[model samples]
Target: MTNTETQVPLARFGISAVEIARVVAVFYARVRSHEVLGPVFAAHVADWPEHEDKIARFWRNAILREKSYSGNPMREHVSRPDVKAEHFPLWLGLFHDVLRTELPERTALQWGALADRIGEGFRTGIVAMRQPKDQPPKLF
Candidate 1:
């Protein structure tokens, strides 16, 4: 066989669409109730159900390869002035808790790792977006 491969799809993690729905639902429920994140999200999201559905679509595309998601997540997050870098850790902690509660141990662990990476990306991107272009980027 050529050096080609097929390891990119997250579907190999055995995540189901139903689980994705449940996790997104639970995680956002917590987010809305969170003291630090609730107000930030409430400022922009008028329709909770619609926002949850769209997020579910994103996870479905990421985990199930449905390719149904079409939104720019980084743009969405970075454009919001209230979405501070401090919120990502809280968001991810809630997410990991939901994952651990909703999925099997190994699956939750793998999904948590993926979420960690995604959260880091969001945090760094938001930080850079807020940084001045003329000044040197903060090393930390």
Candidate 2:
């Protein structure tokens, strides 16, 4: 990549709400088509349209500080039995891929780090939930 592409300014560009919505929509579309994760996601998201809206709001809040999302992500994931430790890495990989493909280099890197942190947090949380209550917490 050229220096210009690699060194894009860090200013948020004030990415609009509509643009953020588009990003979430496109990302989820890609996720739904993924071979390794599609079935797991589909099985868990019975009302995918609603789930999509919730996810869009979450991303908007995360990236734009919009306070648009109020749902508990941990609660949602923990409630689903199919989401396991291994699934997190797969999900992060896919998310990183999508960001890289759809966004500028700087933006991709920014989002990639965020994705990694969130994935690690979720993985650790999920493992903790799976453990016996009497056992000490397992650090990730």
Candidate 3:
């Protein structure tokens, strides 16, 4: 519960390209219509189709470690000042919801765990990236 630590959730394991694509597609559809997260995405992403493809590719690479994606996701999110740590749960929830319905129970649980870990990492990075200007720096 320290200031430097965050709530880390457990995750599971990978998947196929088509399944990954479906997960991304369903998840983004919910995100686009989400009241809280919709605006955040819309503000940063102008092209939904392109963004969706990149995201699908990113997930595919992350899950399979296929080395297909090249984008630095941490840097991308950290650069967005409007993105807060609180938003991770909302995004993760939507992702899990879509996975459960579109995928098998085991598949959903595995990806749910993976998504949780990813969200935690992203949140931690975002918080660290947003440290106050006057805060003392620490090497950890």
RMSD of each: 3.6, 7.0, 9.9
Model 2 segments more than 4 A misplaced: 1-14
- Candidate 2 total steric clashes: 0
Error of 2 at 44 (Å): 2.3
Which residue pairs of candidate 3 clash? 11-113
* Model 3 Cα lDDT, one tens digit per residue, 98-121: 998999999889888878988899
Q: Flag the better candidate by TM-score, 1 or 2.
A: 1
Which of the predicted structures, 1 or 2, would earn the higher lDDT when compared with the native? 1
In candidate 2, residue 137 scores what lDDT? Answer: 89
Q: Give candidate 1 misplaced runs (Cα > 4 Å).
A: 1-10
Please write out the lDDT profile of model 1 over residues 1-140, one tens digit for every residue: 33237544547488888898899999888998999999999999999999999999987887677789998999999999889898899999899999999999999998889889888999999999899999888654
Model 1 superposed RMSD (Cα): 3.6
TM-score per model over all chains? 0.89, 0.81, 0.84
Work out how many backbone clashes candidate 3 has: 1
Q: Rank order by lDDT, top first?
A: 1, 3, 2
Instruction: Score each candidate by Cα lDDT.
Output: 0.88, 0.78, 0.82
**TM-score leader:** 1
